[model samples]
Target chain A: MSEILYRILIQGGSYKVIFNGLLATLRISCFSLIIGTILGALICMLRMSRVKVFKFISSVYILILRGSPVLMLLMLMYYGIFARSSLEAETIAVITFSLNVAAHIAELLRASIDATDYGQVEAARTLGFSAWQAFRLVTLPQVIRIAKPVYQSTTINLIQWTSVVGYVSITDLTRVINNIASRTMQPMITIIIGMLIYLGLAYIIHGIFALSDYLQTRREEAA
Target chain B: MKKFLLVLAILLVTSSAFADDYVGFLSRLKTTPDEFFMMMKNSWSTGGWVILGGDHSSSKARFYDTLTQMQLALNSGEIDEMILPDFVADYLLKINYNYSRCCISSSGKMGLCFGFMKENAALRDKWNEALSSMLNDYSLIGLAYKYVKNIPEDESYDEIYGINRKQLNKEKRIKFEHFKDAPTVKVAVTGDLPPVDFIGEDGLPAGYSVAVLAEIGRRLHVNISIINVNAGARTAALVSGRADIVFWYEINKSLSVQPDVPDEVILSMPYLNWDKFFHVTLSDTE
Candidate 1:
């Protein structure tokens, strides 16, 4: 175990590169998550709207984004769409990943909103609450509670998908690990380290979500 | 149990008819498609695949991400035959002690030369003039021998491939000369090509090509900057101005396959050349 640890930490000063890669992965994942969630909320609102045109627009957007593979989307964004542009690969990765995540989040949010009891909105209206007021106070809070679990999962998936950013020339965790493994000719140990890093990141995200859920439940109990 | 053992023995004997014979090829999925890939593809379809195994199946052609993977596959029985440079095979067989190879053909003429943009004709001429001097002196052959000394010592070249090694003075020397005005040249090479260009222990590019280029730079009064790139990015490196020269083997075949490579890029005279491909295989013990 010590020898393995020594090799992992000491060989070729590769740990530094792997750490830098982890940071790049996190940066892309976080920025994409924020952008995706905001865009997803807007998409969810449009999808929930009574207007036929808005509903149609949201449906087409979801259909296209969800249909394509993330790898294909990333390639198109980097090599085809931005082939002539001066945009850096990391910027392109964020844009592509954000668009990808927004489609799934839109569906998740739409389902959560739909699953809310319609009678609650009716009750709010009987108490002289406006449609906007009813949605803001009664429906939105319940939607958050119902959607949080799925939203957490979607965020974790977004983080993992950032590994393929290497296709566009961004040195994310997985790509760097593969490069090191190729150079050292030790795929077994290098792969384990990569997996451990990803597992650690995933656990942190899970912990934060769990903590949020625990706090929310406590606040409800207090109420 | 006796009946099962008898059935197993029969099955093993029957499976021997389809003995594991895999020919490894570098795919564009990982590396760039060069003349080596094209030649292998053509040869496989024509008859080379049958020579190694019985028939070409979808499973017979194994794809490798890097030459190192191909080397490992050659050891692990994942692949039986691999298309590799003559020198690389010699070095591996010398060290591994469990691998053997047979010469396929030394008749294929391919030039390993430096490439430049069409507008850079003056630079190309200067480099070509320098290369000719080295080729005449046999110093380049000396350098190749320094890195790899395994020359085909048998009379098989003429008998099988109709090429006479002795008549051609297969060895050449490259002289090192200082230039009064050395221009800085950025050269691109795929670092995954072992014994030619590969990442060394210190995480920097090191190999036979690295040594050869360093010597060329010294002689030409040119400062050489090597940009290590993937096979896929080699052409792009030249087109995007990231590299001024590309040290590629067989420019005609490598560039012909890549449509994006512009007509403006020109190939220099052959400095390094390989005449044949060898059939690399594992010994029974391995």
Candidate 2:
């Protein structure tokens, strides 16, 4: 067992490759999550629009993005949509993952926003604020508060989904893990280490969410 | 009315232009075979599709679930041609034969060999000796024609090996060794590959490669256990000491593509040579 551990973690500097892969996964996930959040916020507004055309377009976008598998989406973006484009696979991966995350985030945010008390927006409106002001001051804050936990879960899912970027030849964590396992021919230890790293990432995300939740609660209490 | 007619003409022209673009793209495609199944070379310099690492090489193409899907992609005009080993292409063509849609383009031969750890040099030589014997005795050819050529049973054994059933069994039987310290060898095999290494219907690893390994083990007087693994895990199985040997093809090309692969592994003698590949496409006859 110690020998297996040594083979996985120490032998021939295999950990370096695995670490590089982790960085790739984190890079893709971070960029995709940031872009997706911004795009999703815009999409949420479009979904909530009074105009039928805007709502229809947003619904169709959500349906298409959310309906397909992320791996399929990544493949299409890499091989089909961006096939002739000079863009790198990393760029294509970010775009595909962001679009996919945006669709889900739009729905998640929409549900949270809708679940909030409409009377709060009405109260803000009655205070001589415009519709936009009411939504920003009263509705958006509550939406964020409601959606915070779900957002963390979605972020972790996006991180996991980024593993498939290897299809486009991006050496994300899973691919690197597989590569190490392949080279060492010691799949058990290599894979266990890989899984532990992923699990650690998940725990890190979970802790960050928990910390954010704690801060928000304390701030609300102080208020 | 003229404006409406002009808009309709423009739409028709635009759609047809899109179709033309699709056709043009198909004609220019250079497909590389995906490594999801049987292991082979990725870096043959004959306009074969090479799946490049994430270094963002200009030539890297798409990854398919399998070779058959890649063939389907080729037929449906999604890809122009697949650059796969002659052995794989032939195997695919035989099972999914439609001669009208495809044609074989013979490339130069690739040497197939078993990859071993540097420490297993003695074992490698022993296996090499066994392979040479099989090659000389025409047993290997018989095995190849049986699995690779898909020659009919009953006829292939006698016709290829020139030995009847009883003699063939006798030739395969292991002699008892009284030695207590003979090492048991563990060999890694991907049971997904047919005619080479595959899980038989009876749930045992059975194929030409397995039969060869068995014969080698019999002669060496060592117990050989076949460890089944996913195609991707073959190398890791070797490096991790989970399996001492793996049947590999075109080791030089594989190493060239994946330079990060440790220098510990070495190749045995080339057991088989595959030099022909076919381009499968939709027939223009329709």
Candidate 3:
């Protein structure tokens, strides 16, 4: 075991490479999440719209994204979109992941919107607010509140999903672990380390969400 | 109490008979033309499926043989489970194809075949006492070192003598003569092949190529860095001066421009060899 572990770790330099890879992974995932959230909000609005065509299009988009495996989507984006073009792999990964996440996020957001009491929107309408105004002033805020926990959980899933980017040649944490395992021929040790890092990231994200929830509740109490 | 016990024994026998009938159904299912055709179709759709397709009848027969053997082993509890080793399971399964045989071939003196077999929990436990001793005796590092040393170094006819061990050693160990004046020796490899260039869980670059490079770096006392470049971006990486060395290259006989890469791109001696062969046996049907 020690022999295998020795093969994985050198005195200094290798650790730096792994750290850099992790940073690249985090940067890509965060960028994807931000893009995904904005796109998802718009899609969610379309999904809830009175216009049948708009709702149908959004539903189909969601169905396709959810039905297909993320791995296949990543491949399609890399080969289909970027292979013939000038876009780099990292850029392709970001776009693909963002689109994939948007599909999931749109569904979550739509659900949250539906979960809001119909009375709130009706009241806003009675007060002479437009449909958009009702959503913004009365409905959207409650929906955001209700969806925060699910959104946070999805963010964690997105981070883990980012591991697949390595297939497209982006050196994420899992890719690093795979390299180490191959080098050392000590897959067991390398996999354990990778699992721990992922779990650690998940825990940190969960803690942040919890803290945000606590603060929101505290503010409500103060009011 | 005696009557209840007899009734329970009868029920157990009836269930066992039903199980045998179910196994017969599965055995028949394994040989159906439609089922075999579907499996082939699935394999074609998936990239790596090894198509044993010749005659449909023969393919079905082969399938039945494998499935029946597997089922018998399962029912008898001879081998409790079928377990694929990580590398084979992960890499091989990703490609849609049919496998001719489940066991790794032993022709190349590769150690992985045995390692994969040993991954079977029942086999590992059954032979644990003997296998443990054997494993302790087997030094994989020593074997790898021996294998690495045996690769022949290339020499030009212009050389005073064909490159010998002494010259090879000097060439490997010698510092780049232009290193002091030249730009840093940066290397790039595809980041997708983990255990080649990517960093590992230990927070280090631990792939086979990386490990070799790290050794080379230590011996030469040069500051070397491995840049993670995507497969499609390798040419761009070289042209942009982002990397001085491409970590991998394969020789293709059919491609004319294969060897037309940079003159500075020194090809390493091939460290591994692979060969494909078919085992033929005369059969009455043929």
Model 1: runs farther than 4 Å from truth?
Answer: A1-9, B1-20, B28-59, B68-77, B86-191, B195-272, B275-286
DockQ in order: 0.09, 0.02, 0.10
Of the two candidates 1 and 3, the one with more favorable TM-score, higher being better, is 1
**Could you arrange the candidates by TM-score from highest to lowest?**
1, 3, 2
Q: How accurate locally, in lDDT, is each candidate?
A: 0.69, 0.64, 0.54
The lowest-lDDT stretch of 10 consecutive residues in candidate 2 chain A is A179-188
Candidate 2 Cα lDDT to native: 0.64
Cα lDDT for residue A127, model 2? 90
Q: What would the per-residue lDDT of candidate 1 be over residues B77-96, giving only the tens digit for each residue?
A: 77767766565565555444
Error of 3 at B72 (Å): 26
Task: Put down candidate 2 lDDT per residue, B138-170, tens digits, no spaces.
Answer: 877876766556522332346686656455434
lDDT of 2 by residue, A1-223 (tens): 6655654565545567567779999999999999999999899989999999999999999999999999877766665667667686688899999999999999999999889999988888889999999988888788888998899899999988887765665667776665544333334456667788888999999999999889988998999
* Per-residue alpha-carbon lDDT of candidate 1 for residues A46-130, written as tens digits (9 for 90 to 100): 9988999999999999999999999779877775777677787789899999999999999999999889999999999999999
DockQ of predicted candidate 1: 0.09
Specify the CAPRI tier of model 3.
incorrect
